[model samples]
Target: MFNISLRHSALPIALFVFTLMALTKMRPPNLWAHTQFLLSYDVGTVRRSLIGQGLAWVFESGLMQSTIFALAAVLTLSGAAAMVLFMARALARLDGGAEVLLVFVTSVGMVTFLCNTGYLEGALALVGVAALILPVRGALPLIAKCVLCIVGVLIHDIMLPTFALLVGLQLFLSRDELPVASRIALGALPVALTAAVLTALFLLSPDAAESYDTVFATVTDRALDFPTRKGAVEAVMSYGPGMEPAYDSVWGSDLYRFELIYISWIGVAITLWLLVAAARLISHRPMLDRLALVAAGLGPLSLLLVAFDVSRLLGVAILHAFLVIAVVLLIDESARVKLRSVFTQQAIVLLLIVNVVVGFRPLNGYPEFGDDFPGAVMELPLWWNMPPSGGRLTQNPGE
Candidate 1:
């Protein structure tokens, strides 16, 4: 009886373990994250200062590491809850059982949230989740959606591509329910609002009145410990020169180096796997619908041209794809039927085993790209056996 009960309760056990792992591995708010909340209108209006400005109004100079940590936890938990709810609803439609849920909990997109806790990624994901839920599940006013998009952009301009992909796909999928003019306006409104906000932030916001040293001093004074990554604070304060130093490191000619290329291909493979899974869930749809969905899923990758955070962006793309898929599963019976046919117990069990082996890792800038790739677990044994004089593992293996 005990063994039988344990077998039946495996799913809940797995979920509990996964949550514990995420909590245990949670990192402290880094200097970049601290710098984001430290910035405010008092320093002069700047890009990505909205959150800081709002916190400043409420905290009235009481912002500290504890506050930032608490806020980060809230945002991360809120986003995770939203995502799990959506996933649960979608799985319900497919009659997906323990194995399928296990696959989801272990999947790269979900695990990215677990491993890379406490960053704007959580807040950005929350906005994306709102985009998914509000359109289908709620009667949220158009103005509210517009306001959400505006807030998303203000949080970080990276929200633009993510917003575009999600909102555009949702609008596109609603073609049968809404009129042509309404759809066009609905689509264009967010774009226009985003553009206005971006212009105001970049062109109209006042330049920093203080030097990097002055701003850094002010930020460190509020912290319990010395903030690491001074360059991040410098970037926020100086705006231009401080940003230049990262260019060569992140986007240098070595972009095409063999290791980076290999890691990038691994990311691409994982992305393709996700796209394939989404496609399978909607295989019964028309060719146009299928193509459009795939296109939207691929859209976030365009951020590559401007951003060097390959793994993080790919994780965003994967989550964006999942959110879009969940929306479709909730609203479209045809898609749900396709998902049911594709996600059999045997298939889900096999996928779950594979995902568990892949496990989870932090997906950030280049080299550390993609959670699906072999990470610390795979490399640790080799490191343990290496000669003492070999030194630590550097980003570039040749070094």
Candidate 2:
């Protein structure tokens, strides 16, 4: 019997429109994102080729740059809408204080969507959202969840960490309902399949350097009018070769330093919000539960050591946290009541204000791209922003 009136719905609607406008202004799907469309199974089974292959199957042959960009934008916006709707629906079931916290989290997610437009992460997020929603609604069967996990990994292997977090938390929360052996097998299934998929991608795919050239040529030839960045193309191409090349590329560079500092600041903000929002639910949980939550939440951060895209991994981590919160609120009435009691209207409003003022920067440090307002507060004090050394390769052209 939960009904959400138009008055209650205005915030999410406005935020969605705001996201659309922001994306339009930004004019995203940068060279890197566009390059992804150039890849497909035509070149053989490759990492992150699922979307590209699907696009190719749909479009048949050569596709215009504008068309590719449009498709990417549609996927990004669709994923953003899904996230917003999920939050809004969840918000309706909560009390005032919890509602405000949900808004805070949703706003951050919207900003992230804008920041990551045109990337596979947006689509991956949609898959993640679907996974979270189905289980919460008691509609997803175990076999289906496993299949979805496989689909997510095929879309992009980076999703494995988040999948781990999702599956682990679900199993942990439902521990009492399931037998010990059942829990262990269900939990291990996804991990084993993910490993198998990744191993196949590595062993089956052609040599990295050769495939990189073929992909680059295919992309450039298809979009003769589009200006493709070699670095961005290489960045994606390097995925099949594993993280060693990525590590070597960014290790001693100024880009590495900038990423370290920027993520450090953003990480603090994310940690604060999570602590405040989850304090009630987690504060009184048993030591094992707390440890499990922490481990699951930090799971995505494992990608940071190998990937130079610090913000993207962090963004995934944020999504994992949101999923954890949503699942807890959906199933644990006691936790919800506890949260309502601890958070006051005044404090919630104050936190929301701080969240707005602090704003969010792009996953990459390119200020020239994307909306300029609500820049990170840390940017002012650090003043070390010289757009990272080695120019375009080190700098991600913001989406």
> Global lDDT of each model?
0.60, 0.60
Model 2: residues >4 Å from true position, as ranges? 1-26, 136-140, 236-248, 272-279, 282-285, 363-365, 368-399
lDDT per residue as tens, model 2, 321-394: 66666656665666676655555555555655654544344543366322322233323444576542323333
Where does the lowest 10-residue lDDT sum fall in candidate 1? 390-399
What would the per-residue lDDT of candidate 1 be over residues 1-399, giving only the tens digit for each residue?
A: 111123355446556856775675455555566666766666555567677778877877546677787887777766766676666656562445344555666666666665455667678767866765665323464566777888888887777777655665666666546765665566566667877887777764433444555655655655544464554454443344444434345455333232244345655666666677777776766666667677767777787676565555666666766666676676677777676456665656566565555533353222343233344333545666853221232342111
The window of 10 residues in a row where model 2 has the poorest summed lDDT is 369-378
Best by TM-score: 2
Q: Give each model a TM-score.
A: 0.78, 0.80
lDDT of 2 at 308: 64
